[model samples]
Target: MAGEVVGHAAEAAAHGVDLIPVVALLGAAVIGVPLFKRIGLGSVLGYLAAGLLLGPSGIGLINDPESVLTTAELGVVMFLFIIGLEMEPSRLWALRKQIFGLGVLQVAVCGLLLTGMGVLLGFAPAVAFIFGMGFVLTSTAIVMQILGERGELSSESGQRIVSILLLEDLAIVPLLAVVAFLAPSSGDEVGLTARLIGIALPIGAVSLLIFLGQRIMNPFFAVLASSKLREVMTAAALLVVLGAALLFQAVGLSMAMGAFLAGVLLSTSTFRHQLEADVEPFRGILLGLFFLAVGMSLNLTTVAGSWQIIALSVVTYMAVKAAAIYAIARALKASHAEALERAVLMGQGGEFAFVLYTTAASAGIIDGPTNAVFTATVIVSMVLTPFLLIGMRRLMPKPEQSMDGIETVAELHERILVIGFGRFGQIATQTLLGQGHRLSIIDNDTDMIRAAAQFGFKVYYGDGTRLDILRAAGAANVDLVLICVNDKAAATTIAHLFRDEFPLVKVMARAFDRVHAIELIKAGVDYQLREMFESALMFGAQAIRELGATEDEVEQTIEGVRDRDAQRFKLQLMDDLSAVDAARSLLLKNAAEQAREGGVDIEEEAVEEEVAKSTQPVPPA
Candidate 1:
């Protein structure tokens, strides 16, 4: 009995020990993320800091960071998968020039420059080449996260950056092959057949993944979805991602690339949205943990022993890489500002350096100590990246709008201040212009302002979201502020700001949709109109007229719609938002029933179509 109790106690203690790391990691993230985000340094830096605290160098809570890093890498795989979902095959094909032309030029140039730098620092040609190539691969996680935060991932420039990153990811496979070729031979050499097999394996794995994905993924998802078990669907999504990732890793391709390819294959699948939603939560958590693991992996002892070497390598490599990137960007016809931005964003050596260095060390290409030092240098460089970006933002001049033919916001004594000069704003201004009411109009788009000037309308260059710009536009003196910006968030912010600070200034805003209109009302705007609402209503009324409805009947039907819409809006304002869902379902059910009575099988034909259409902005009412 005593021996059994001791064994049980020991097992229980082992279980408790296992839970410690999980608790520590979560606690660190919880404490770290919010604090760092609050100060604007970003959550990435926060996770790094927390990881440093929990790491062996700090308090030694988690000694083997490699174990955690291994798991955390899945986060990166999922992140790539999500990115692939956003990139449809057609859109990706559209970016082929940027991906191949620009991406190739940047990587080749940067790799050459960095390799030369490494050799100049007294390393052998092969070793230096390995080091340089590793650094050339930028951290996709860090860059993507920053771009996502800035909401630039969908921007034209952002897509160009993404294209370059994709090329870097592809470069990893060839790079590994190069590493193997460079490794010191141990008498038994790889024959031509072995080399051929080596090449064939990856090709076979990739072909198989494509075949299965194209032929089976959708149908498999369809079957799982029919089970109506949400958890099972989520599990299936994970299984697909991990299975693809493992297959790629086995074939010496990066797991992230494999997951990305799988995502692209499923991009057009009917279940794309569901897969994305299922993976998002896991991606976010694990991605954060990945950063944390990186921080924990930073060996303070290694850095302290070789601080000068690590520091010199970090500075020299980053500077050389940045210079190469800037020069290449300019050569590619990018503007000075864009060149500088791209250089700063991609300057740091990335996570893949560890993988490359470790592999090289195992193959006797570099010593273990050299690997440790280089790894530390990469981590330090990664840590400094956010700071460099923040400093660059502060020092770099904002792209100045040319005031050659455009006026700046100044003390204009107009009674009405128009925040945006877009199509909606231009049309709204026309009514006031016809009445001879002089109005001050401002827009941030230089091209738009210039074009408006061509049309004999003077649009000033200023961002309405800035309080100072608003004041300079005579917003304080204006009796009313007309906010017609197409951006929903910015419009809402402006409306809320005016309602709080310039309370007496009647504000009229343009909304993107019904939800935006409701938000504007809550922001205390005097009036708000969905940009598409009136035009759509007029279009529908015209359609009814074309169907031979009398003018009186058409007018009555329009009035009914208008009244019903007002009632729904009022109910939404009172916070009973569920009414919208209830009303929509009831209407769809009634229509389906009527169709059934009319001898149509609604479920067999129109249910899917109607369900899809119902998700669009609820009809005016």
Candidate 2:
């Protein structure tokens, strides 16, 4: 009895020990993330700080960071999966040029430069190459997280950066193979069969993954979805992600790469959005943990013991890598601002460095002390990246775009001022021009202005949302202001500004949709027209005429639509009955009815859909 009680107590103690690390990690993340974000250091830094505080170097809440890191790496895998879901195969194909062209160039140039720097720092040639190549693979999690936070992930420049990162991810495979080849030959050198297997295995794993993604995944998801269990769906998502990651890892390929390919395959799946939603929570938590693990993995003892070497290495490596990246970007026609941003983001060695260093150490290519110093240097560099970006933002000058032939908004006496020169503005300008109304045109797009100049349109470069630009464009002197910009928010702001500052000028604005129309009305614009309303009405009228309706019938039908829209608009403005709300309620009713029916007739669903669409407010054009 005594022995059993003692055994039970020991078991309980073990369980408690397991629970404590989880609690500490969560507590640190909860505290660190918010504090860092509030202070403007960013969540990544917050996680790092929290991790460091809990690591062996600090209070020692968690002694083994490597164990945490192994699990936390799943966060990176899921992140890549989510990114893959966003990148449709077609869209990814569209970026093939940038991916292969710019990606290859950046990697080759940065690798060579970093390798040369390593050599200059007195490392042996083979060791220097490993150091350089390891650093060459930038932290995808860090870059992607920052871009996502800034909402630039879908931008053209962002896509270009993503392409470079993709190439870097692919480069890891060959880099690992290089590490193996560079390792000092033991008495028993690797056999030819082993070398061939090493090469063939990764390729086979990738091919198997492709086949599973194309042929099995969607159907597998479909089967799981039919079960109609939310937990089961979530489990399936995890299974797919983990399974793919495991397959690649087993074959010595990148787990993140495997997950990414799986995501790309599922990008066109009907379950794409559902998969994203299911994985998002896990992705966010794990990714944070991953960063925390990275922070904990930082060997402060190692850093402290070899402070000079680590510090010098961090500074020298980061500088050389950043310079190389910046030069490559500039060579690829990136603007100064873009090149600088890329440089700041990609300056540090990533989590992959640890993997490379470990492999090299295991292979006896690098000594333990060298591995420790290099690892410490990488961690220091990662920690400094956020600070470097902050400094760059503060100190970097705003790039001055060439305006050799472009004209700025000047004081003009024209009767009308058109703020935007987009398709809508250009078409509107034609009507006023036909009526012989003198007007001044302004647009924020430099390329558009240049394009317009080719066709003899005197469009000036000016931001419509800026008060100074509006004033310079003679908004106060103009009889009317045309806010024909595509952005709903910008149009509303311009309208509100004119109503307050240029009360004498009648503000006529283009609405993005029904909601925008209401917003413009609240802004007290003298005239507001939904950009697509008139055109859509005309299109429908033409369809009616083609369906054998007489000319008068088509005209009368269009007039009825116009009148009903006006009535709805007025009602929406007065907060009486919202057309949008009414339409939403109708949709909910239809959905509920369909659910109750357990599969409504196809014809009925179509009819209900048409009804919903007709009354449904069109989204922003």
Q: Considering every candidate listed, which one attains the maximal lDDT? A: 1
Per residue, candidate 2 scores C-alpha lDDT tens digits across 309-392 of 788888988998899889888887888899989999999988888888899899899999999898888888888999998888
Candidate 1 lDDT trough over 10 residues, lowest sum = 612-621
Q: TM-scores across all candidates?
A: 0.72, 0.70
lDDT of each: 0.89, 0.87
Tell me the deviation in Å of residue 458 in model 1.
7.4
Window of ten residues with lowest summed lDDT in model 2:
612-621
Clashing pairs in 2: none
Number of the top TM-score candidate: 1
- How displaced is residue 600 in candidate 1, in Å? 97
